[model samples]
Target: MKQGVQGSPGKPVAARVPAQARPAADGGPYRERDASVRGEHTHEERPGAGQRATVQRSSVRGQILDALRTALATGELKPGEVHSAPVLGERFGVSATPVREAMQQLALEGAVEVVPNRGFRVVERGARELAELAEVRALLEVPVMLRLARTVPAERWTELRPLAEETVRAAAMGCPAGYAESDRAFHRELLALSGNEQLVRIADDLHRRAQWPPVRHGRADLVADAAEHMALLDALAVGDLDVVRGLMGEHFAGTG
Candidate 1:
């Protein structure tokens, strides 16, 4: 049995009842026990509920990842945070399997590191490391923004205004999910302006990583960030390639 702190000490642990123990459609002894447990329901009792729960679980995983990312961004999930797979699994009411999977994904994205016996933990970035990464992103994206300025038509600028408005609203409201989505929308519009599909994909991957930090709603940080974005748009509007490049460099530097 997988041991985890399911509840308060000595509280009846979640019994690892097997699939075969679940009631066969006829409502046998299995159904009786399943029903007697107060407020406890299994996937077998409600067919669609299982699917719904699976969806909910997937959503929860996303939430967990968001939480993990926030912790890392804010330096909570630091070098010695003891981010054991089993402990995290227990906190999220999931088996270690999904936690391991999520950790592996994080590792692939440079968010976490896995040590042989210690499981996984956030990757600590030194000042120099962060500066270098920021420089790399700036080199890759600044020219892209300049290219967009030269290539994107006037009509496309108007088309992008709505998403920019949405981003401003999201940042103002301090809704993390809304902010994340709106931020994505704003960048996607920028990428679309470039008209290079490959550039769009690469830019998306880099942009998504910036959403890791948690922003307090209505905070000065968000307001300042939004103002910077507005500045970027204004520079783009003027077709000032050098200014746009500088703004993009600053924007990515802020992310790191």
Candidate 2:
């Protein structure tokens, strides 16, 4: 597994593992490319689902990775929090092998740290590290927002607004988990608008990392966040590049 940024309760840390950046489904050094052999897919092979069939195997690994990612992003696994293989295995309803395997992948991806005898721990980013990530986002994402401003499909916003609204409402209700998922969905949809898969993936990883910190207790405040999203939607309607860029920047910066 690739190593991610490491933070202590009292110290800031950032360590990234290279292999973690590869598709999570295929992250482990021992991963086989074929999903059927891995028992990740059970459907009988069809004639024309060639590529689709192969992709399905990767889907299990992806689901496992996503589950871990979501757990980390939502602060369910706080920075430096350690979870044993047996515990995680039981929770996920798999054997320790896959759980251990998944942790290794996360470690490679810079999401966790592994010790010789101790189990895996979720990585933590110190305030400074968090700021650095925000800077990176500001640099890479702001331009994408500009591109989106120029090219976004008029009808796409309609599809996006509801999700954003739902996110805001979830946050308002102090439903951190729901709100976080909605928030992720909101940005993922925005990235979809940009129509750049690579860019979207990078942005997603960054956004997921940003959400590592737990939300403060403020249901009313989250309600206000809904307003913030609505404001961005309005900017989208008018093609206000400046507002779009500004709001997105503020949104990410606030996460840190």
Q: Whole-model Cα lDDT per candidate?
A: 0.59, 0.64
Q: For every model shown, what is its TM-score relative to the native structure?
A: 0.67, 0.67
Per-residue alpha-carbon lDDT of model 2 for 85-140, expressed as tens digits? 65564455433454577778878667788966768877777889788877887887
Q: Show the lowest summed lDDT stretch of 10 residues, model 2.
A: 12-21
User: Candidate 1 on 10-117: residue-level lDDT in tens?
Assistant: 432233323332222222222323444667554333554555545444554565566555455443455534467667655654455545666777787776678788
Specify the highest-lDDT model's number. 2
Worst 10 residues of 1 by lDDT: 21-30
Prediction 2 global C-alpha lDDT? 0.64
